[model samples]
Target: MLFLLILFLGGPAVLTSGRVWPLYGTPRKTVTLSSYGGHVFQEEGVWNYSTMLLREDMDVLILGARETIFALDLNNITNKKAMVKWEVIPDTQEICSLKGKTKETECQNYIRILHKMSDGRMYVCGTNAFNPTCDYMSYTHGNLSLESKHLEGKGKCPFDPFQRSTSEFVDGELYSATTLNFLGSEPVMMRSLNDSIRTEFSRSWLSEPSFIGMKHVAEGQKNPEGDDDKIYLFFSEAGLEYDSYKKMDVSRVARVCKGDLGGQRTLQKKWTSFLKARLDCPVSQTKLPFLIQDVFLYCPGDWSTCVFYGVFTPQTDMLQYSAVCTYRIQDIRDVFSKSKFKAMDSSSSRWVTYNGDVPEPRPGACINNNARQKKFFKSLDLPDKTLQFVKDKLLMDQAVEPSSKEPLLVKKGAAFTSIVVASTTALDGSIHQVMFIGTASGSVLKAVNYDEETVITEEVQLFAHSVPVKILRLSTTMGQLYAGSDVAAVQMPLSSCDHYTSCMDCVLARDPFCGWDLISNSCVAINSIQPDTHSEVVQSLRDGKASRCPAVESSTTIKFFYPGNMVSLLCEPGSNLAQVQWHVNGHPVENSNVYQIQHNTLLILKASDSDTGHYNCTSVETIKGVDYMTQSATYELRLGDFMTDPSVQPLVQEHQNTLLALKVLVIILTLMLLALVAWNFYKGYFAIPKCFNSDEESQQKTSGCQKPLQTGGRNSAASKACSSNSNNNHNRLSGNQHNGDQVF
Candidate 1:
């Protein structure tokens, strides 16, 4: 019984709890960049792993390779004529090669940033063979061509292609957080408009920051006294003020005002609106902090309800796991407004909180009407003391915490690389958010949140090769997901409704984009149905109740077998969370040496006449507090004699025929042997000598073949007697021969 319990619990049963439920099939459509002329260089080491941008209105995808940029048609990606490519000049290649860098790998222009300006033109930046440069790409007459005007790209793009950087373009201005030096030692957050305004954090403010993402959020306030738009940047940096023995890296969320100009006479041509705070995403069970990898913004309807989903991993690489945490916009705002200020105390040589009075216009506040009322219309008009205070108080003491202490999804064995989110409206008019997380293995995990529990519905392999996914873009208008990798980019549909073949599969998927259609008996996309006619759609994803599914009746199958034969019966319960039970003749079957149960299979070893009976299998499932039972078709097993069974009649006949054929072969060989013996006798093969008589051998035995002398000596003794006996013997032989001739 213990062995049976172990097998039942640890067998090949699907786990529908915290683990991922594998999808039956992949997406229907997949478009790779190689199908078009995206990478025509065709070199061994060159890669197209740059970021990707989707223009849904234009129905095109824009991506950058090493020195080229490609625009692909989204509808028909394979149509090469609809594609366009632009290759930047390689004039600075020789200069970059002389910089002691790897010419083959590093000393090449790598296109990294592509942002569309407020005008029709696009702003592009590249490493430019280690000499960073930026250019404008004009789109006119259905063609994209590079302009002659070149701008310095030190603060706009990173000097290394492998460096982590982020940029966003808003209102003809570019805001970016990137490394500006060749060695990637100097990290800066800069804004470039008519004039570039750059700021580098002091060691006390930021230490070795690695930027991940940047987003421009607009505050939807029409009041003239309200603040303007703001740009938030997310990064992870080494902590310098932590009172610990070892150094630690902390995740940070920073914000900057959109309208702040450079301060005059104090911090010229530099940002005066930079303020950052720590971001906390802690595991409740382990109490270990996680480092942020990537962040995605989920804004369905209003900006106030927007949430940021961040992918985090342990600071140390010893733990091979990842987690996802969500933060509301309101929580982030509260942290920035109410957090204390941290400043270095030179007297004690340690960091301490500043309890001094704050400046009038609160450091890092957006330029509002209040600033204008105080005769400070721009950052240049602010006092020198105000600018110094803002710079010194850049680091906030309070950390921004996630909404839940527990993570939304904690995945083991894979590190998340990118993330995107979408929302769907259920029949109850509630909005549910679904997250699609990309991993380092070029696969995507689809998960949904049911109250507080996050369940993984499916995992899809987006690339044939296991290259890391560099970028992931979601298009709500086209209902597609675009993933970029080192070799190619693939476009797949957001929801694969047709993959679900049955009502149970459709409901169990818990996909917001899919629902069961009773008319077609298939899973269909919610968007495909008309707005007013979807009342009959069955959408019980949360409960997973299969009551609406039609029950199938299976017929009894009778099987015959001889005694001592092994029998196996298969039982399919259909659901992953079900327990299978086997019964023989309406009595429960117990596990023993002769009877074994493996998953949904019942094995009967060395079956006998007593084992002949009706076998049935039942499946029991417990969801919430209710139990549902389903039964399989009955199996009739009968035992019979091996020789009398009708099924063994042909085999018995075959054995008899084989035995008769063997007997006939033996008889034919014996007859042939007899014939050979008779032939040898007729050919005189067994002839014997007539003088070799037994009595002569005893009386006149000679020494060898030459017996003349011995015979003479024996003859002298009985010459007279022998002569008389020989005459009688001759007469007797003549009489016998005459008698034999008369008989013949």
Candidate 2:
């Protein structure tokens, strides 16, 4: 009876007035798939794959678990498809193996970075198993294994993956990001792609061990005629502190011409170099107090032109806050030619921080490079066109702020580990850059800017519970976006779910891990609560030792029907220690005449049309230590059903009115007929009796009848007289009949 009552009241159709359909159920299975590279992976350790990149032919480079590296193929995997195709421990295993190292079956060797070199070979870098090393391998199409001629060099491989380095192919030379430490130290702005080539021009202004960070700024950019002969390298020094950010310090942007990648071994003027001033960011500097972890350059459009974007944060805040910053490819290059360096005295140089550095023309610095050009100035690089250094700010805010127009804070923050940008065309036919930010909190937030501004036009939260996002990347084919945190690697198709309009913080506050789009509105998965129809044994026998649930007693999550939608509830399952009360905002969901409980579930039948708010499923549990109360996943309840568009609601009302009018008319007609019958019966019993024939008239009537029978002449005359009297009596009766008739 209890179950029946709950079902009757809280069924999706009943509660919602037949609006929304419930779409979530108990998760069938949560498998922590193998990490890219690991020794002994715990069942829960599948969340560790954080760094990712796409190789040629849809192969993915995944970095995780100490020195482990796995290349996976993501062509055929989804919630519905339960299969994975991957190649484990690429051919660099020989270089990763350490001699005399105590091996404990634990995955010790892990691949940190994978970079494709100029010679069509792959350079794989390990942070360090026993000792950090770079392994070089040549890749062949359709083959999974690395075809290496030999392990020619140990640690001298010129390609470094972790440092902020950019590479390009110029003439016959390759340039890359190189640094002092295995991870990073003093930075080498740019270098030849191959370790064997040592050119004179390569060692001059661009020569420095990569300690800070470096990347290719104008790679693949072509002149108007479309010749891609030249490339630009953006380099910065490391260990430099920011105005108010982190301990680590770095410059904004510098350039090394590929024309300088290969030259003579020794020369006064080796690699041609140009230095650009640092960008000015205002809002993020005050909020985020950390330094940048990395930078990535994106070529978002068909034109060879590019934009340099980086991830930044503050150093002090315990909870890391970060931002993403963007600059145009032309702005940095123009800075060098725009400003002239004033000579500094020896004593003045020691006192002045950037004494030798040049300044912009005038009104030089704007958050975005919107400063106007001066009427006249001298530029050594472009003498004809006066040099003017200007800054162009694209986006701001650690995550995309829905309202702010500043550039993203391209610095590291608490709970944040990695950032990557995916460039794609939106439904509007316009190009957009989707940024995936991984936080230390173990959650991933995807942000994209629309309206030609930096504010996050849309933000969606991924992951059920908070888990740090360690690394993220987009596929070359623009097919999918992959994210890696500490424990699991998640794959999201380019257009999988609806674009989330609300920010993650807003979703978290309401505890509605699920949302329905108000526009092309549909119920979407914000948590791991999926749509499963397998009808688990637990759904029947509530406490009969059925299959174990997928969630822990304190944080288990389930999806149930409420009104017009599937409400995902994160709560403790099966434990009935105390009153299990459901609340919206802070109001309790009480059991009254319409409230019901079933299988440890609460259902509200005839859910009020106005009860839309955040619903919380709260349960109090007392263990050995103390009493504790926990709330399930927050559900943001929006009124009405996506299935029942409001445009048709009025038609139903009109149909109902027509039926009511017909019923009222039938009742009125029946009452009138009953009254007429009662009146006729009263007249027959009272008024008609009063008009009964008198004794004389009765006698005359009888006599008339008898006279007609008499045969004699005397009786015939008497019969004639009686007939006249009888005729009078008959006339009176006919007259009375007219008066007594009742009209209906």
Candidate 3:
């Protein structure tokens, strides 16, 4: 049965272990840059923020753009930045133009790589008019200087600006996954400078891949066997593993050992420790598969326990849906080290799990202490049979499952493009992971990821329009996030504490960066508070409860208006998560035509004699299975008919036995007036007037019937003439009767 299903899917099923993602989400607050006071950096002609590097030690954010590189101050990005400019020469532009590429867009230097070298220098690269090149750069005294010579960057940098690639400088060597040709046909994962190990030139190895990012991982002191460090690449590639109805791309994570130096003869110049596995992040109960767009690696302390936070979107463009899934290092390691190998059946041409005898010592096992004990210290020492076996069985049968068996966050209406995670210690002494996700719409969603449930605290909008988030960086120590788009780069604090002015708002925001300070009686940044007053600060990140806030007397806003006037009582709420309710004379405000609540505003349809009372507005918010209610606002609706001396006690805040007000009264009065008019019209209270028209007697005006418009002098004369004709006709009929003359 498993083989049949695998053949039907066109490839072996990688979704053996998976779970569902919830469709519901919390109400998140939206903030704009103009209102939130975020610092922005946009040089006169600088655009296309392709790459960003945050150096907390130097207190600056380095940005890479088209033909330019900028080093903006972390304190305030609006300040002038240290810059280095690189442009494509005329000869290079001409050569690029002759290749059938757009001279204006493709024939230019687009800075793509900004890697830090081991010696504290910078390694930067650009697509120099379809020709990639690299240079060493130095930053000193808030300025940038470049090395005299440049290196060929065909493998180090992508030939095109839009192609996705990942590279890092590890231990004075470069490990990269990118396309090497001018047309970007070849995709290779290689290690250079110290080793010449690369992937085999076969479709089974890559199959048209789009690389996301790469991370170097060593088992650290926690490893018992001291395994060789590995570089893992995250990407999405076409489902060449299947022969389905439509071309579907699957997310993948591939590993390559640092010590691999290719094989002696069987797979010469190719890595012997190359293996790939699928990353299963199926969204919703329908089991819709999502393609990975970006990944952020979070390591608490040891490299062995690193976490990969991946942002995904569905291949179907029906909805702009996105999700963030988390994968642990141990889960990925187990799949490659212990999971079964996926292989193609020779007779059926269907991909299936291999049940044959496994190669001894493992085909792609790194040279750990176990292998070293057996005298296999490197890839060159491995037998030809192991190398040939690994080359054909590059894919593992089992996939790497997510940590929680579900996505950390799932959202609709926004296509998430990049992400950065931060671990924060809230006032409750509990650690929480805050994920800052950048969207294609140029907004950042700050989502608090619980173990199984997720809540979005807020959304900060950076650009006024849609601009893809090309670069996103986070500085944990500074509590700031840097986001770059096609237009500019923006630096924003992790939280807007000032936006939550009240104690209830601060606590209910569920923001780990903000807390309600009892000493100052205001919402403040947690880091800005004094250490001595740490206990005085209140924060509840788990459920965002305001139960710790002391009760206060809500000020009554007295509003006096004339009778028959409409009064709108507004309830300004602090948090979007709470529901607003209004009360009149101490009872729940019944929603009638006369009394309406719209967009948190209470409207008294028309202030009348009986509309004199007080209106109280309250907010009820649920946090961690507990409901917390607070009086947000109060209003005294005093009609002119009830205004009296101030010494007298006012009316109650809410009214009981509430009935429909002005609208009902008006409807009854209108009906009575219409009935009386109809009865009198049929009874002829005044003397009835009859008038006739030659066109139609039924169309003439008369007081006994439904009257038409009363015309003046001309109609009166016509009525008199018609009366005379009737009288003469009656007289002639009497004379004819007297004369016994029968007229038919």
Candidate 4:
């Protein structure tokens, strides 16, 4: 009786099943990250390797591990590189521990610098038991050698093991931004080697800054009038303008001219052209400000068109949301060159703009041909008043804006840590910028800036567990992405063509790196072609329409299910973003109780004569308000009349006996309920009905509160009726045929 009641009312188990379905934003490919090239540190000892340098020329990745150095093979196909250790003395380690330092974790040497010099050598440095030191090193063909002598590394390297520091070499000078003290309180930007110059200690100069990245820009090449090159630094620090009770963090971009020589008298050995401005990336709906975490510079030979992409995250919100904002090189120039200065010593307490008359030749401007023509070419020749005014006035009044005045991409529940972009050319001779963003959840999202919006195409897992991605580098020539974490460094292909097998799947992916080849009838990379302009390849990135695929009929398969068994027809659509459509007898599915679409499978509750027909499945994609479809699978379902055969008598009789038992059980329960009601009435538990229809009571009908049972019997009045469904299914099913004879 319980089973029959559930079936008559449509059981919830059939309506809701424990199945996970593929939806939009699902990645087409998933592969675990692998680590290799470890002979010294082993697998379990590989820690503090979040920073690395890719030497593509040598086909190796230079790493700075804890008290050790290694060079892993490029592409990671075969691990072969140098593996060496650089440790401190036992007496030094004991002294470090006595001064309230950790012996196992913090007191050991941690190599933090692996900078490439103008000459073919590496300038390496390490925190030797809290006393930093530096030396010159050489690596070639799995061999390593360090200089016999080490030098003092005060401003070139940070005293702390994990302090945020960035350094690069330009014109044979090492320009570094790091701390100067053991406690990491003194932040400085200095250029060492060949007349070293450093920034003076002032609250207005740096203000508790945490530097992220620094890049050298070639500003002289784009100017018709001669000018010097520049070095731009991106960081986040406490806001100096906003008045709030809590700490407010804001992003900043500081710039210094490469040819900036120190001032003469008032500000000797100090940069005169050091200026910084605010970076704004605000989400309008949430009104949350995102702070910059990392920046990548893309300059394809010209400085004017160079663009900088930065990864940003919220200040204090617990959410894992992130945003990507872009700034053109030209827009940054306008803010620094045209905007007024924020006076460091204003009369009022608040930060005020300077409205006084500016000095001639622009005190904080790089020396150009115009300045030379006016007899003001060198920093040493500048006036004392001009140098003194620029000493404290380094902040600009205007803030730099993004290319579209908004974030290019805003993703929720994923904190982006690093980003790298590559310019790709499609088959239609159009260029698109593909960005590979690394998240804190150890995954990489592949997105493209199309028209004015961003579309995320694919997501690939680069690590087995949830770990933060500290470094991400793109190799356009090799077509791969190399990601780095504290314990692993893995390589992933930029284009995964093997996931898509059919033509429709290849086009629907909308990936610029992959396309469908009509000649071979398989998906392949765009670069695999000879000239890269093939007529057989098909790619619809703008619309993602799959109707362009040529018509090819799939082989028809005959399927027969027993009288009372569940049937499922699976449809194979390669992409998760596609919409699957199912039709029966060349018409749409009509009945809900019989047919259901779940997890790309068409399910039938109980197969019978009424469920027999020809079924077809196709994949549809929508783009720009138009639908494109291509056939993928087809099936013919037939229910054989097994009741007419003598061998099937036992099964049919068993099904009938179960139904009879349910009816008998329902009658017994009804009698017990009547006896209880009579006793309740005698004890005056409730009042009886006072009025009723006389004619209705005389005709003996079933009570309105009683539920009617549903049975699938051929002798029932509804089943024997000659309706439209019977006319359509009469021609396909035979009277006395069984499936066992036709198909095993």
Candidate 5:
């Protein structure tokens, strides 16, 4: 009875089964710059989105193009009125062309710097036709307009639009690290306080530096005697301390005191507290090390706990691969404060650590109360010897390693151009950080950082064309992402919850913003939850645990033929990480002539009566050291005699039976027609005589009449008399025959 119940409930089994289809990542929404009227065109030059800034308070995003700036509203990106465009003047074009620059390509203004000031205005800078320029932008009454006032942006901006540079606004001043000349041969790190206190041209300061970014690090409030606000600049420059034999480009992280003023006498209007250190990002197995490409600062709460995420690539092939590493703010401070300074010893002709007599106050220390009370109030009070020592001793002897020791992400096939990170709480209430990396192919990859490893959650195509994404900005307050490419700027939501329909898909996505809502039976963004409403939501971004998902019951069944029949069972596992297993009659499958496994399918060759049983396919996955198993629909296989069993009969057998019946009917009709012909011949209905053959009786009677005729001569009288007697006998015979006929 139990077997019959299992058979009835399990239903018929299928001949072929395999794993389920996998789900690919896609974007939920995408808005291009053209949709918001932010795209601009130039007849002689090309325009590209090179820089981006997000304004969470006003719900608008700012994008920088070649000679143009666009402001797009985040709420309605398609509205034309919600966007604004501002273009720089073309007065420097002829001057740049006369200086041997390409008019159609390089001799055009390219907006590079867009720093928001503490006031309501913004400081904008551009490479105006190979002559760097800066201007003030005012945003009042919800309208962005450029001011007529302009400043010489020599050290504060790069003359070439394609040159890499970075700038930051600190204490109503702009500190930038960029090339200062039109030829792009001179690189300098300058402090622009009304453009008078900038660094003078000197080889000891900066040697062809390609700056990535500048970050402002403030002192911790808990430490009363801690350092002042320090502005750190990350870049790569040509190593000058070493000779030509050992000359190579080295990655560096330099820091400057925000309170530093110009020196008193000899080194006037120069940075008196400038220092730098080496940043190492080497390959583990090869000599190809990672060159710094870009950097982003993530400060969650405290300055000491801040992290710096940097993108690096090899110089050999720019389009092949890239890597991302993280550095803690404390580690950087340690390298800057405790590491020894590198100096060139002329006598030895080699670079070595400084071991000379030290000054009373540190050369690169910020001006504090002790120095102020001693009449050393500012950088101007510092001596020329101390300033010169700091100028030549910028590079640190020790190198700073990344916090993770290894890269957080190593992307292949496409080079990474920009990166931004965000954090979210998982179901376990633990914070998880997710990194959004932009590629040169105009795609954004979302990766989650877990305890064991980093898992790529999804990839989104941000642009219709394969243009490089130059800038990426994330708004954690609004949960939106802004990407800028050469062709256009795009805005999209960070989490695409609608793409994940089921609990399994939502959990496996590993996206902290997505959760499976039990009340609605759909995946939804956690940020969309109402403040007062309460609902059952499950998020497993860290561990990808799907224990809360409801069990799925399947009722589908399949059946196949028996005896020398081949059968294949398909079981869809749904996930690429899952392993498929086959079970027959509630027992695990074994390799034999009757059963063969092919990927997610089970093949049975020459099926017999013993092979008849229930078959099931299960998928097993291991996530965070825990096993998860899911079973597919049950299938029942039955074997019976091909000749007698109706269940095992095929449709072709019915056709064969009909053909056999037609042959039998034809044979019966032919036999009946032959019997009718034989009966007609027996009854002489088609013949002329009743006797069909002449026998010896008739021949003997003819011979007897001839013998009397031959003796006729001697018996002529006898013949005549016999004739008379015969006539009488004939009459008597006729009378007897007539009587016999009458009696009958």
Candidate 6:
């Protein structure tokens, strides 16, 4: 059966009548670059990977541990750093006078949050004096304000600015989350704008058991009528049922008005409420718990409509994995209007619960003002009376029709440890929502929904795979990503000029920032191209220049010369073969070889005027089939007198013909003489030449011509003997002797 099939298939192939044979195909070229290996980094610091701010104005600012902030250029110029506009704030322990602050030496008291206010001032907040103090500084010129109320005396800061604080500026108000002290944190959300400031604690507003962290993602984001700005906060804690059980159900996204902040306090309505809802999380097991570690606001162009993205994970010690949950801001506002969980005259609202096997406590339980509760209450400066009227107007059972449409629920089951969302305008003028995440295993993952069908994920393992990512933040410009933990800070350029393929390859190649120094074995940038710096071969691409390549020429002939020799090659204007290589016969010359390849490949080599030959160049190309080998114009090298050797000349004409005829005449005469002598010798007689005077006995042989042995003798031995005897006599007498004797 196999033989029959083979014959059937071979019929047309054997005939060679059809065109399609073996199916046309080209090799798939997939680029592969390594992501593993190690090399020394030029910058010194640990866990400083998260970026707090990214601006495209050629200036990128990043906040790291130990108060290390780096202002770098769009192009990575970290090395050969002439001057780093930087300053390292001392650790909280060394600078803060708090008793145990010095004992806890590992505490990173550097700046945790950075935001530019409406006044063009950059506000930096530290965890405490031990954590550093909250201070406002002019971003353009380094003008720092009095270190708030936190940095005073032997050191008693009202708040720990570095302690997981989230700050946002809205309508001239700076809202932030801060722990009151280092000992037992009195976590609270504070608002400051001009002269007025106020604080709302866990006891009065959120009414939660405790607090975790807060993230304010809405920057200058507001409601349509522009009456009030909505700032979203995500908070997490242990559930009421499972006291020690760290559950994500305890995590809640809430909205508050910016105008209500830093105003006259009221019993029940100290802060104007907007909305709150439990994140729809996916988790298992009551013992293994979850919490909202961080929150990020993402507004992909449609400012009025935005997605609230949060990082939900287990309590630090109990966390099994990480997850990312997304909810719409409109849904959260629904929670505040409900009668089931409303603050009526200072009385806490009823707590609701769910029976799902998900994160323990159901949504609706309030957040007790931790880091997660600090919102950019830059809410549109609305009248308190209007907010009160809206709250009063909202009926308990009546559903509030959200101004914005429901958020498209995407990526419900996956987890992440940290998330930061930013809006960016693509090169095409379209806006996109980007979420940056740091995984438990120290993997930095970026998630973006380019379409309704797909979510893109690109991740890089930042740590040694063991150190879980503690924090991650992407600069607003989205140009840098920073990841930090207990160890090191890693900063990478988010947008670089190099191709993405080349970037991956460069990473895989493990080329260190150390500039390549020919004197030493190191990988360096070719830009540092000083003679002594390094020997690098830079590839200059000339799109469709010239072809001086011998490889493109006919295989039959090739000529080679040192560089600087003048030789030329011709090529069509639109040839696919863009490059030309000059070969001597068959061998290719090394790049450094004296032969120079030019733009036109007029193969301009500096010739000593002596170099000339049938120089061959080939224009090589890989096309659909049959690789093309194009030959250049054939050149006949004509050298000047000094270049040509006179000793090497073509042969003379007369001597050539004379030699041919003289040789023919000699052969004919010899043969004739032999015939005569043989005839006589065969008849038992001897013969002598006319010129030879021989005895009568010897000479008498000439008369006896007895049939000459029939010329062509029947006996082979007789014939040979006759031929030999005749041949010897011819040699004895010559034409010269006959001619001379005749004359005498």
Which numbered prediction scores highest in TM-score against the true structure?
3
Candidate 4 lDDT, 1-744, residue by residue in tens: 233224423321111222222132344334343321112223457577666776777777777778878777666623746777789889988988898889898888888777777677888888888888888888865697788467888888887777788887787888888899887899999888776888889878888988888889999886987888989999888867654455566799988888888888877888888889989875533333568988999986589889999989887555455788899998998998899988844555666688887787776788899889988777877777778778867788888888877777877766888999988888887888888888888788888866765667777767644777778878886777777776666677777776676787678678898899888888888878656448878888888776768764665776777778888898865444557888888997644988888877899888888878899888765555776564467888876557554336678899899999999999999999999999999999987653245654433232322111344675344433534345545544553245545775
* Model 1 CA deviation exceeding 4 Å by range: 1-46, 79-91, 94-98, 138-144, 148-150, 223-225, 552-744
Per-residue lDDT for 355 in model 1?
91
RMSD of each: 14.5, 27.9, 16.4, 25.8, 20.8, 27.2
| Global lDDT of each candidate | 0.72, 0.40, 0.80, 0.75, 0.71, 0.42
Ranking by lDDT: 3, 4, 1, 5, 6, 2
- Quote the lDDT for 387 in model 6: 42
Sort order, TM-score high to low: 3, 4, 1, 5, 6, 2
Residue pairs that clash (backbone atoms under 3 angstroms), model 4: none
Worst 10 residues of 2 by lDDT: 21-30
- The clash count for each model shown is 0, 84, 8, 0, 20, 56
Candidate 2 global lDDT: 0.40
Model number with the top lDDT = 3
lDDT of 5 by residue, 1-744 (tens): 233223323221111113121221222223343332232222234368777766666666666787677666765444322324444356668778888888987887788998888776778888888878888886567677888567888988899888899988877888998887878887877888564455557665677778888999886355456457888899887766544443356677888888777788856777777777777664433242457878889988878778999887765552355677899988987887677777888898767788776564666777765666667877888877777777777667777777976676665656778888888865556787888888777777787777746767766777654787788888888777777777777777777777665676677667788888888889887767654433488777667788998865654575756688788778877455667878887899978867888888889988887878899887766667876664466777766556655554665688899999999999999999999999998898876432323464344342232224345566776656656765787789899999999999
The C-alpha local distance difference test score for the whole of candidate 3 amounts to 0.80
Full-model lDDT, candidate 5: 0.71
How do all models score by TM-score? 0.74, 0.46, 0.81, 0.76, 0.71, 0.47
Query: Which has the higher TM-score value, candidate number 1 or candidate number 4?
Result: 4
The count of residue-pair clashes in candidate 5 stands at 20
For lDDT, candidate 3 versus 5, the one ahead is 3
Please state the error at residue 182 of candidate 3 in Å: 2.0
lDDT for each residue of candidate 2 in 271-316, tens digit (9 for 90 to 100): 3233334343323214322344556667766434666666655444
Which tens-of-lDDT digit does each residue in 89-125 have in candidate 6?
Answer: 4544455544544434334544565666656555555
